[model samples]
Target: MIVFDLACQPAGHRFEGWFGSSEDFAAQKERGLVACPQCGSHDVEKAVMAPRVGRKGNQSGTRNATSPARTPVASEALPPEVAQAMQKLARMQGEALKNSRWVGDDFAEQSRAMHYGERERETIHGEATAEEAHALIDEGIEVAPLPFPVAPPDETN
Candidate 1:
């Protein structure tokens, strides 16, 4: 007996069927004797065979098992569109932050002072909690969260 992997066309359900031989399977299919066990549909065909399986150390009649995983080399590699977009955004952010000062944890306080005219208004970006951001917005302060986290300048060294 032979086992054939069959798939139903309408529902795309795969199943195995037993037959006496290859000719037997073909005859049964031609005569419309094959039926999908799930939906009783006669439209069925053999499913695509997957990769072969064998013992890990077995090397006979098989491709090399020790080859390194494929990695795209420079010049041959292509940058994804999203990667290009992110690069452009990073460039824009770097330009924006070129003149902005980092206030570390005192982002909310300094921002509030600038907003209320207690201090001169200037471009600034720093860490602020969700609650602090919400409070700033509630008090009519314009604050936007940075798309990425920044390391404090003092910590970089």
Candidate 2:
């Protein structure tokens, strides 16, 4: 996997996206599958990122406590336990979404409707802007972001 720092157009909301490769990123973006989690915008572009290079094992240096530690690259191998945990989490999400309805871009509206008793309360999963989600929480409506991105049913192969 490869990780890229991405920023959405106009809103400029920044986030990290993981893809199998640069080609995969291009393909997804072309298909409008890549979108800003914050604003649900598909107009996104790669943000300038500094390359991460690890020091040699023999290199020893005094590091300031205030300095940030290097983060692990997504392409690196994961510990077995970590990998298993991620798989388990994915399975759990899948199970939970099994009975959930997909409202696509109407997530916030639908959630609001249900919250206000305008619509029957039911399990739902869909896209919502960060602002919308914040507003939902502020209104005392229960909402949570999915651990992993879900492909819209209409876009699934």
Q: All predictions: root-mean-square deviation over Cα?
A: 21.1, 13.3
- Model 2 quality (TM-score): 0.57
Please give, for residues 32-150, the per-residue lDDT of candidate 1 as tens digits: 56777666688999888663456566556655779776796543233576567657878888898889999977999999999889999999988776678789999999987554445
Clashes of each: 0, 0
Q: Candidate 1 has which clashing residue pairs, if any? A: none
Off by over 4 Å in 1: 1-79
Enumerate residue pairs that collide in model 2.
none
Name the best candidate (by TM-score).
2
Candidate 1's TM-score: 0.49
lDDT of 2 by residue, 1-157 (tens): 8899999998998889999999989866764678876566889999999876778898787776899999876554666776787799999999999999999989999999999999899999998776788899999999997767798999889
Worst 10 residues of 1 by lDDT: 73-82
